[model samples]
Structure formats: structure tokens, C-alpha cells
Target: MAAQLPIPIYSSLEDAFGGLRTASGQSVRWANLAQEFKSRFGREPAYIARAPGRVNLIGDHIDYVLFGVLPAAVEHDILIACGPSMSPVSSNSGSVAAHNLDPRYVPQTFAPMLKSAPLPTASEERDAENTVHAESWHMDIDTKELRWESYVKAGYYGVLNHFFPAAAGSTTTGPHPVPVDLLVTGCVPAGSGLSSSAAMVVASTLAFLAVNNKVVGLTKGELVEMAMENEKRVGVNSGGMDQAASVICTPDTALYITFFPSLSAQPTPLPTSRTVPRAVFVCANSLVVSDKVVGAKTRYNLRVVETLVGARVLAHHIGVVLAPTERPTLREVLGRWLGFYEAKNVPSDLDTDMLREGVQKILPYVEKLRPTRDDGELGVTMEEMIEWSGMPEAEFRQVYLSWVDVEATHFQLYKRTKHVFEEALRVLRFRDVCFSSEAAILPRDTLIDLGALMNESHQSSIELCENSCPEVDELVRLAREAGAFGSRVTGAGWGGCTVSLVAEDMVDEFIRSMKSTYPPYKYLGDDELREVIFATKPSSGAFVLKL
Candidate 1:
């Protein structure tokens, strides 16, 4: 059963986060990938792995620091058809080859690195030289750099080391390591806000696991953790949001995933025909792909580093004695500070009012920010953040800003912290509207409230986070003007795609009007625009198919 099946099942999506929710099914046939796999590899694919792309309805950029994020798995996904090679066993075991049907991605044929033993688990720490584990197979040169193939290799290695160790052959009962022929086909656009990279990595991981007979018993949560750790080989400090959303999402419902206490995904019920007069979600690409891999130093990773540094500075301001190398997030710092204010007998669960009140208490500690020479637009500098900090520069540097180098001395401590906490609350509010008892009686009002939350999220991302670029702003503006209920940048901003709320009846007009007015959509033909800009429902989690 383990060899024949895909992943563990969930009875409901809520049980998934609390445990997960399930949905009405929607699936496409694997006729093309199946045919392509056979055509290229000379045999049928033993199994296929599919992972969907997600559209964030409200929450943005809060997942990394470990807060709640609400994202819906859209219909588009990455699919990989794979099977173990039937050829005679090689003297060396760690051989795997991958082919992308799109042709944009170059195929890689890898030979075993001739390891002394099996690969190490991703959870294990690397030595000072950052060498691969003693048992591992390959070494990715330069831990900071990212390559297209590295993502795939990370997935392959994750499953291989976890399930098939060096000693696996001598004593293990499961399938042994074999050369895998992988054929990838993706509907999700790369560098779009929809998370194409995570989907690809997940699809690859599942495929590798299945071919090696490692799929059946693995829980969704377990797979999610593996995917998140595997992608870290690419070097960005991304959170579990993308990986978890792709794996645990249910169609017609958005997953409200929380990483703090533990990994859990609560599938919030989306409006249905029965609950509402009409409801639809549309995703429009700015046509500017914000590839996190490229320019990570200046763009994404810088923000990540800034947040951690900001967290450390705030902890210092509050007199919280944290060890060096401790990177507490804004959420953690806020909770600690809230405890400080509560003094004796702090409430275990603080409501929004109480949290906002906590912010009020901490407000006096926050100084009017001083700008740095470069990147002052992000708001405050490291120097200004610790102007009130008595901690020495060397110690601060050792503790917080050591992970990634930044050209900007100034960081947006206030904005970054403010956005994460407020947006985390906004996500909760959006979920509230989705599940409110009044949703059935007052669908239009509920929808309007939800739209307003999305609008606020966009403004915050633009004004507070400063991650939204001109292209993204323009597209969001165009969508709203074209009659979207609300629109916001869906992925890690700077440029990518925007998700919009719309009425089901108004979907046709909304798409048409935006296409005519928007430059990117104006240039594309109707058929092209249809694929590029369309409404979608929440989709299912990653699963394997016996092809």
C-alpha cells in the first residue's frame, strides 16, 4: 500500500490546520505528461506528483517571521511525472536525471558524488566548511548562491537521505535508490506571485518519494516540513507558507496556516453559491516576474535580514535579555512586551484590542526614526533603531545583522514590525467574515467587508512595507477601477501578480475592462489574456497519481 499510494489523507481541512478541510473535486488528466514521460523515458511513469500554486487573499510577508497567513491554492499547479530507471544498477547509486517539458528549464543529468555513506537529513546542521553531510551525495557550492537546478536537487536529496540512506540497500525493506527520469510540466507561471518554485520543489519531492516507495505513510505536515527545509539550500530565509499551502490547501477554501505554536492549517470556508449571490477571485499578472532567486541580496533577503535585526533591536529596547544569534520575530517580541505590561497574571489569549493596547504601551519605546544614507525609503536605519540601544555595535552585529550583508544601514523596523502584526490581525478578520454567521444572511455586506480588508492589505504592503513596485500598483489600480471588489499584491511583492475579489456575474466585464486598459493585457491576444488573467477557485493539496 505504501508503494502504491500517494500521501496520507485528511477527512476535513480544518482537522488539518486544527487538522484540514476537503472540497468538491476538480482534476485535469495527465495525458500530456504521461505521454511525454513515456516518449522521453521509454516507459510509463510509475507515479506523478502534483503541487498547486496559491493566491494569498489577505496576509502578505508575515509567514517568514512565523505568523498566521491565509492563502488559497489556485487551480494552476506544477506537475512532475517520474519513475525509477529500469536499467541495470550502476556501481554508484546516487544518479538522477530531470527533464522539463517546457524547454525553458535545462535538463540535468547527475552522477553520484561517491559518498562514504547515505545523505544526511535536511534538519542536520552542516560543518563550518558547509560541506555536505558525511553520508550525503552532492555539495552545492556557495551556500548563498541559488541555481535553477539547486531547487530540484534539494528536493531529490531531501527524500533520498530521509528515506533511502547509504545502508538502505543492505538492510532496508523499502525500495532502494535508483536513477530517476523526471519530466516536469507546469501551468503556474515562474516568478509570478503564485509560488511556482515551491510548487516545483514539492512536486519533485513527492515524485522522488513515490518512486522510492516513501510516499504512503508520510503525513501532509511531514511533507511540508521537508519541502521548507529542502528549499533553504537556495539560501533565502523563506517560511513554511508556500510549501504548506501547496500541499494542504483544499479547493473552494483558503488555508489559514499558523506556524508559531506548531504547524497547523485551518481551511476557512470560502463563499459558495448557496452562501452568496455571487463570488469569484481573479489573478492578474503585472508581467514583471519578481524572481526571488535573482537579486535576492538587495530585494527579498535584505528585508528578511532587516526584520530579524529589527526584532533584536526591539527586544533590546524592551530589556529582554536574548542570547546572541537569537532572532525573535516581531510577533515574539510583541508577546514578550505584552507580558511585561501585564506584569502579573497576563491573559493567555489576548484579543485584538489587547494587542493594540500592547502596541500603545510599546509606542513610547519607539522613537521617531532617523533615516540612513541608502534605502531610507524603507524608513529607519540599524543605527537609528539602536540609537536608544546601549548595546555595542560589534555585539549587535554579531547577534542580528550577521546573516546577510546589506548596503543600507537604515532598516524599516517600525514599518516591517507594524505590517506583520497588523496584517496578521487582518488575516484573522478576513477569515472571520468568511465564516461569520451573517455571511449567509448578508453575503454582499460580508463580501464588501472582506474586500475592504484586502484593500487595506494592499495599501499597507505599498505604504508600510514598500515592497510594491509601480507596475504592481498600476495593475492593482487597474483591477479596482475595472470593478474588482478589491485587489492586492498576492506574492512577495516588488513585482509579480495581484489577486482580486469580484462577483461571479461581473467576472466577464472585469476581465474585459482590465485587459483593454492595462498595457500588458492590451498587447496580449484574447486567448493569451484569458490564460494570463482569469478567475480561479481554491484547489487541492499535492498528491501523487499512478500514471
Candidate 2:
């Protein structure tokens, strides 16, 4: 019942992928895909979902705790060609067959398993209302290891549970949504910071929703949440930033996505000079992949724990009790403090500026309280955190550590929290520069200034967040030397891709120079290098296309 297909349907043979102002050759591309789907599925496809990969323009590592992030959807994307299965192939069940055009990923076909597939526990389903109904059959995908198809299964299960809750038994009477067949192909580089996994998940969810006609009434925010929860099944504790960007973004613009009170998005216009009118973002791969999934224990999820623990310790030290619902985002803590200061200090005639400044000054950066025992292991002990909090061990563990096991002792509390706040501020400033009136007077300088912020962001990620690796920093240096105005690692750092604010006119030379100068590129063949190291325009958000 979606007002329109998530993707455009091509009624005219002429329009295939043409209606959405799809990339230059994308129209032809979709037309060909439709024919290919027909050949593979033995029927014409019912729908196609397009979810573009994203590059974090400024903000990084701050989104999951509900922070504002600026990101743009790139041209590279995961395209899901979907059609109903022609046969159930069994008396009791149906199946979803998937193909990877790239062949790098093993093809996957999934079905509803009544007992063998592990469904979510009632508590894990997000809410009481979302509990698995006796009639609801939410087939669980085994994400035990590095299975390529885990992403596909995650998306399928994500939408399945959301729209067509499987009634526990196959005998239960309900609307029988045909099992779907999906053929996925994409230009997005996998394992790079471009968010290819998110694109795949979003694209698959759209396909399932579209196939069931469940898309009509659902809002974008609802879909965003569903996709995020789906990803958590794969063990990565993601914030909605990537999924939000894929869902809410528009073509040729960056989205300033804020997630404080509610998920809201505003398009921030990029200033491009007449000659260089379109913002040119060059994504240079560091060739390092930070697997947020299994590595969740040591990297991304570990940082989430650190921030939570830090917030608890900070709150206890300052005598501010945390409300059960409040997460330990520094921004939220400061807001609460501001409210308290106003209530108490106004009567004392305290200078408002001094009171506000005093609040920041009073907040301490206690490294001893950090959960990380070693930055290398990215683990922290309960005893260390409890000692720092000056609170009961049980209270600290229940409030902050929760169910996670902190196995390492070294932590970088000062650095990680410092990066989140500073980077959050930088994202705002970077967005302001794009909108500032003076941007016209010094457009080039303005872009350069933006790059400087990126440089600072990378430096902080390395020095403080400890997310950057040797290759990540080296890539930034090389991109800078290659005439990038500014560049920094995009995604979860460690290894992935770098986003360089490149001058439009200089992009060709910039990419070429980077290839020649970087040692990694020395090994990639010309065609491979061309594809991986290229300039990108801010592309459209996730959508559907029909043939």
C-alpha cells in the first residue's frame, strides 16, 4: 500500500531506469537486469530495490548513541531484483532464491524453518507487542561466522518479521506471501567504508516489503528502525545513520541527520562553483576492512560499551543520577546539566556564560574509569570502572556494562569520548560552512577549510579514538599530497575507504596521482584501480525500480 513503489516502475519500455534521473547508463542497466531476472526466475521480476552506499562526510563513530551525522549516498549501490517464486517446492513451505551477479558472493536461497531456524526470543524482539506470535513464523538466519549470505538473510528476516510475521506453524492460516527470488548486483565496493552491507540490507528489506505490498503505510523512520534491528542480528550494534542516509537522502545533497528527540533529516546544500558546481567526493580505499560484525567484541561494540561506562562514571561523580531511559550521550548529559544549572543559578545572579562554561570545566576526563584495559584488546574490567565511579559494583554493572564481557584492561576513555564530542561539533561547523554566505567569496578556501576539518577528524580518530591504522593515516597523507583539499578515513576506521574533499576540476589528476603514488595501487590492474579509486557525486537515496 505504499503511495508509490519504493522504486520507479518502468511502464514504457523506454524508461526502465530513466525516470529517477538514474546514473548515465543506469536505465540500460535496469532494462538488462529485468531481462536477466526473467531468464533466471523463469518470469518477469515484480520489483527491484536500489539502496545506495554512503560515505560519512564528517561525523564518524557518533551515530549509534543517537547523534547527528552528515553523510551522502554515493552512486555505488546494491540492487536487488526480486520476483515471486513460481513454486513452493514443498507441501509445507516456500523458498527465496538469491543470486550474486558478481560471483564473489556465494548465491543463497532461504526458507522458513519452523524449529531449526532460531527465531528471536520474546525479549529480543524489541517490544512486547513485537513478540513472536504463535502464527508468526520469523525464520532465523544463522550468522555463526563469516558467511557471505548472512547479510542477505539478515535483510530477508528483518522484513519478514516486520511485515509478514510467520505464524509459528506452517498449518496456520494466513495471507500466503509468495517466497521471493532475489538477484543482487552492485557497484558498491564491499568491506570498504562505503556501507555496502547497509545498502544490501536496506535493498533486501525493500524487496520483501514490496513483494508483500506492505510498504504503503509504513513511514521511513519505521523502516529505518527495522533495518537497524535487522543488522544487530548479525552482531554489529549500528546506529541508524547509515540506514537513515539510505532511506532519507536525495540526489546531489548531503543529509544532516539528527537522532536526538526523534529521527529527523534536513538536506544541506553543497556549494559547488560554476566550474565545479557539483560536490566531488573521491572515496579512496585503504584496502583494510574493519569487520564491525564479528569484530564487534574488540572494535565498534567495545567503543559503545566504553562510552556507556564513561557516562555512568561521569554521572555518578557529578552526583547526577541517570534516568533509566537516558543513554550516556555526552550531548544529553550536558543538556541535563544546563537545565539543572539554570534552575539553581539564576536566583544566585551567576553570570549565565560563566555558569555554562563552568559546567564544561567541571566535567572531568577520568582515564582511570575507562573500560578499556588495553587499547589493543579494547577491553575493560568492572572493578576499574566501579572504582572510578565510586558507586556500588552491582549498580555500575547493571547501568553501564550490562551483559557485555569486558576482557581487556587497557582503555582510552579520554580519547574516545573526546573524539565523539569534538567530531560532533566539527560536523555542525562543516555543515555551517557549506551554508555560510562567505562560502561564495572563498569557495575554494571554504572547501579547503572543510578538508582541514577532515584532517583533524582523521588525526583525532587515530590519536584519540584509536580507530585508524597505519594504512589509514598513510592514505590520508597520500590523498593530501595528491591535491585533495582534505581527506579522512570513512566508516569504522581501522581499514576501509577515505573520503577526500576533492576539487572537481582536479579529480582526474587527483585520482591518477593517488594511484601512481600509493603502493597498494601499484598492484591493482588498470581496470580494478579505475573502479576502486574514482570520484563520486552525492547520489540518490534507497528506492525501487520496476520493469
Compared with the true structure, all predictions reach lDDT values of 0.73, 0.70
lDDT of 1 by residue, 369-472 (tens): 23335644646645765553446778767766565545565567777766776787788778777777743445577777888999999999987777899998
**Candidate 1: C-alpha lDDT:** 0.73
Model 2 C-alpha lDDT per residue in residues 94-182, reported as the tens digit of each score: 46788877767777766655543466577544443312222245544444365656677677666655555544344455455567788
Off by more than 4 A, model 1? 1-29, 88-91, 112-135, 141-147, 165-176, 272-276, 340-390, 438-441
TM-scores, each model vs. reference: 0.85, 0.85
What's the lDDT of the predicted structure labeled candidate 2?
Answer: 0.70
Q: List the RMSD of every prediction in angstroms.
A: 6.1, 6.2
